[model samples]
Target: MLKFLPGILLLQVITVVLVLIAPTELSGWGWLRLVIPVGIVGVLTAAWFSSMAAHHNKDEISRLQECHAKEREALRVNAERAKHRVIKQAHQETIQEVRRTSTQANIKVGMAFAGAAGIGGLLLLTQFITLGLLMLTTAGGALGGYVLRIRQEKAKMELLPKTKTKPRLINASPTTK
Candidate 1:
């Protein structure tokens, strides 16, 4: 009430004092004198509060939009990090597969070499050199297969992107013997 008292007093002062000072043709219109100003003040106050509510609502909407944008940015960052982790894990698995393939190719190469030596020696002792060519051909085929497998593993390794290894933080205890 105190906050509005000045405005109310000003309205009343205008209605009574302004008409009395001018003594206009409408001054004798007794009730119209007070009613007109009261109605005008009421309309002006209503428009003021309506515009104020609109401004407040606009500010609130902008604040909410900012909050939502921040949340979306956070989600995007987390999703990007998750994708990086998945790619790293895939690379690790690919490296492991390449290692396993290399090991298998080496074993195959050794077996082919050993088989060739054994068959060649056996055929030499029996004096069947012409027929021994078939055994040599078989060993050659195994060696070719080994070479192909090794090449495949090398190609896979080259296809992978290079990643730096981060130093791991190991859990160490001083009491350990």
Candidate 2:
């Protein structure tokens, strides 16, 4: 209101001067007086409303910005959680695969031992002592060879360094005859 005081006073003075200078026949002091006050009030009201609107718009923009920030944070957190979940699931799958492979290996070893024992028992029951001893010796030798081979292979695996590179094919494309 104070900022507009000088301009309002100047406007009032101009209107009064115009009314006084006008010809008697054209002049209408009554109309001018009423219009002048209404115009000033209208201008002041417009200024006040516009200022209020600007303040409200600023508040609304800040609120929207805050909401957007919170949404972005939530999205970031969710993404991290999803990544962790995928890693955890993959780890669990790897553990399960290892367990399954170990169980299969154990079953195969048990079957081999059981087969050797059954054959040896059958030979002994038929009164073939020499044949039974030979069979048991052969089975033991074979088992020992298998264990040695497995140990050698395990040692080889341990000696080799782990690599992430893909193996190159010896013959990637077929040659034309």
> Native-vs-model 2 lDDT?
0.74
lDDT of 1 by residue, 1-177 (tens): 354566657666766665576434554577576567667876876676666668878999999999998888777667766777787899789979977987886887797688786897689679988667777777778778877886897798699887675433233245766
- Estimate the TM-score for candidate 1: 0.57
Measured on C-alpha atoms, candidate 1 has an lDDT of: 0.73
Model 2 Cα lDDT, one tens digit per residue, 1-177 = 365466557666866766676556635576676566657766876686678768878999999999998888777667766776777789779979976996798689868976986798799999988888888888888788877887897798689886443333332476699
Residue 173's lDDT within candidate 2 is 73
The candidate that achieves the highest TM-score relative to the unseen native structure: 1
Worst 10 residues of 1 by lDDT: 165-174
What are the clash counts of all predictions, listed in order?
Answer: 0, 0
Best by lDDT: 2
Error of 2 at 151 (Å): 8.1
lDDT for each candidate structure: 0.73, 0.74
